[model samples]
Target: MVDILILLPIISIMIGLYFITLGLWELREGVNRHQYIKYMFTGLFLLFILTPLVWMMVNVLL
Candidate 1:
């Protein structure tokens, strides 16, 4: 349980980075504007919101 908790943030960070990269690629191509926006939003949310939320949860649990 503790190991998983500790790993969550790292996973989120990687996923967030992947999404942001996709978003940037989409932006560069100037195609599928809605998808690009959604991707960017998801990436920011994961990096800024979810990562800290999980970090706080881990701190509380430990």
Candidate 2:
């Protein structure tokens, strides 16, 4: 149980990084095509990626 708790945050961070990479890839295409909505969605995707890390931090700190 303790090991799982420690590992959970690491796993979440890895998943978040993956999403960020995906979002950036999409962002590049959006930039090339001058698509506004894609930019917004990509930004949202990046924000969503931050959620897990933020949650972990809050839990640890408080």
Candidate 3:
């Protein structure tokens, strides 16, 4: 459980970056910027919001 807590953020960051990159690539295409914004927001939410939230939960629970 603790191990998962430690790894969660790292994994989320990697996946989040991947999603953000995909979003950015689509943004460069300039066809459906609004659609890709969802990807970017998802990434940001996972990377920033979820990561710290998990860490805080882990710390409090532990």
Instruction: Report each candidate's C-alpha RMSD, comma-separated, in the order given.
Output: 0.6, 5.2, 1.3
Question: How many Å off is the CA of 39 in candidate 2?
Answer: 10
**Local error of candidate 3 at 49, Å?**
0.6
Q: Global lDDT for candidate 2?
A: 0.59
lDDT tens readout by residue for model 1, 1-62 = 88999999999999999999999999999979999999999999999999999999999999
TM-score of decoy 2 = 0.49
Indicate whether candidate 1 or candidate 2 has the larger TM-score. Answer: 1
Local distance difference test, each candidate: 0.96, 0.59, 0.88
Judging by lDDT against the true structure, name the best candidate.
Answer: 1
Q: Please give, for residues 1-62, the per-residue lDDT of candidate 3 as tens digits.
A: 78987888789889999989989998999899886999899999989999898788878877
- The count of residue-pair clashes in candidate 3 stands at 0
Alpha-carbon TM-score of each model against the true structure = 0.96, 0.49, 0.83
Q: Cα deviation of 24 in candidate 2 (Å)?
A: 0.2
Which pairs of residues have clashing backbones in candidate 1?
A: none
Candidate 3 local distance difference test against the native: 0.88
- How do the residues 1-62 of candidate 2 rate in per-residue lDDT, one tens digit apiece? 56666666666566656655666776677655445445545545545655566567657865
Q: Model 3, which residues run further than 4 Å from truth? A: none
The order of the candidates by lDDT, greatest first, is 1, 3, 2
